[model samples]
Target: MFDLNNFNQESASLIQELQKHVGEITAIRRFFHQHPELSRQEFKTADKIAALLESWNIKVTRNIGGTGLVGVITKGLSSKMIGIRADMDALPIDEATHKDYASVNQGVMHACGHDGHMAMLLLAAKYLSLEATFDGSIVLIFQPDEEDDAGARRMIEDGLFDKFPVDCVFGMHNYPNAPIGQVMISHGPQMAGTIGLEITVTGLGCHAAHAYNGIDSILVAAHIVVGLQTIVARNLPAQDAGVITIASIHAGKANNVIPQSVEMIGTIRYFDPKTAAIMEEKVKSVAQGIAAAFGASADVRLKHGYIATVNHTEQADFCIKTAQKLLKPEAICLTKKPSMGAEDFAFMLAAKPGCYLFIGNGPGDGGCTLHNPAFDFNDANILVGGAFWTQLTLDYLA
Candidate 1:
């Protein structure tokens, strides 16, 4: 365990050691940033990562799920293991930051700091393999398609845990608009689950001048959209925090003709499974009911998305205490409330006892929010993130 009284002194030494390798860490991050790849298509990225792990003498397993890779470093047979995950996919956004290391694959950029995550985990693996200070093992998961195909679930379905079993697992993301190197974690639901909703209302088409001759799907869909909003505000309890967003509506191409059908697309965000269930049921009922009232029928399609990222209390405490010992007091933040965003790591946490936390990425540089074309992962975070992973592994395996 890290002693609060000696944390400052000990952390200083640990950070200094991590700083020595900053050059290599930043270089690796820049390489990934420049050669960004899309989900499940990270061929070159996986090659680079595998080559690096092999160079460090760590056991490497490839193709767990699409382009996913696993690096194992075992120190002794303690029967205790931990898994750390890093996403390895870029988004379909053009680079706008104009950084020297900006993505060269035009219209594809690592706009979500996944490049930074890869560098951090790789550096940690390098250090642990060299130091051999622990008695168990560390499993490094480099997953693909985090933004699209539910890569975490794919890896699990492909037998990730069966092959590389672990007592617990962990994951981290860079928090935008906060001081660089700062850490935030909490118990219970730290991020919401998402459900994508699409509803199509069908009706008879008619001439614009003779509107009463046919049923109006546009009107029915508009009613359904407005009715869906009531699920969170008027239907759900006041204490429950849920969000229903009608993000898109498509009706007719021509203003002169009444469209035969209208489509409504939106999302349902919730922390509690019961809340999500109720919202789904309500959306279907309201859409069908409204369409029936308007003399039309509705077809509802729901695409399930990431689930709520709930953290184990003990694991969350361990994360906080580890961060408090590894960094300055001001750098540790005990989050007050969960964010509305969703994460695929929620799937990994569902199978293991662990927590998914955030490391700060400093202030917004005009367009630093996640998934933005101008977003760039701060290089200053490398040392801090690498050191935190090292200390956590050491303490946990002690």
Candidate 2:
């Protein structure tokens, strides 16, 4: 545990030292906000990041996993190393904030605070390069395509850990609607695993006036949608958590005719693998059974996505202690209830022992929540996030 009394003076000094780099970091964040790129297409984003890191006299490695890069900084004689990660992709949402630095690229925006993440990590890298007294190396990862695809998985498949391995890795994301200056850390599962579901119901097409002549696929599809709900309501235990949402449904084009097939698409979220497996089995069984009862046939497809993000206990405790040194005692929260949302960083945790953290992004009023067009990264978090990153590196590498 961090000694608050012994580290109070050091924390203050670190905050002051971090402040000197805030201006440039904030400007760089805004620049990224203006010139946003979609996943797997972050060519310009990669170029700019590489240029800035090179200018700071850090060794840069490029094209690890399509547009992903790593920056290295070494100090002292120890061989121990730590890895810190930041995502580098923007959503396909148009700019709605109307800020001066709003996205110049149409149909693209930094609605999920990836811009702020990059800036904070960049500041940490720069500060560590200049003032690091710790022994060993620091690996700064700038990953791309976190929105649609798992960039962390891609990086690992492309030999990321093999090329520049570390003892452990760490990642952080901004949490909107939380009080500013507060942080949340979970010891176990912090995010849910996601599964994509696509169901197709096939039946004989017939005129609406004489619907009795043939089976209606649309009607069967509706029943399947309703039946899927029971998987969570009746199948799972009372204490377990899971979600089944039907987001999109497509069937008939005209009111007078029944379509031959209906397509339904949605997502599934759960913290436990057993729960996920049960949901998957139930989804298929329910759809097939309902279709058979309606004289229709069904086909279900499940695309597995990122797994649940489970933080290692020791690393999570270390992170909490490090955060205690930087934040007030009341500002640190150790939560057991995890978010229903999914993160690709879960893949990284699966690869190595690590911890994922959340920093408050202030209020989410006026459509500022994540994935919303009006969302923007709060500039106020630069100092706190950067200082935390810097201090965590120093302590972990010491």
Candidate 1 residue pairs in backbone clash: none
Whole-model lDDT, model 1: 0.88
lDDT for 2 (candidate 2): 22
| Model 1 weakest lDDT span, ten residues long | 1-10
Residues 136-207, candidate 1: write the lDDT tens digits: 989999999999978999999999999999888899899888777777887899889999989889998999
Off by over 4 Å in 1: 1-7
| Candidate 2 regions with alpha-carbon error over 4 angstroms | 1-8
lDDT tens per residue, model 2, 285-333: 9999999999999999999998999999999999998988777766677
Per-model RMSD to reference: 2.7, 2.7
Error of 2 at 248 (Å): 1.0
Would you list the C-alpha lDDT of every candidate in the order shown?
0.88, 0.90
TM-score of 2: 0.96
Error of 1 at 214 (Å): 1.7
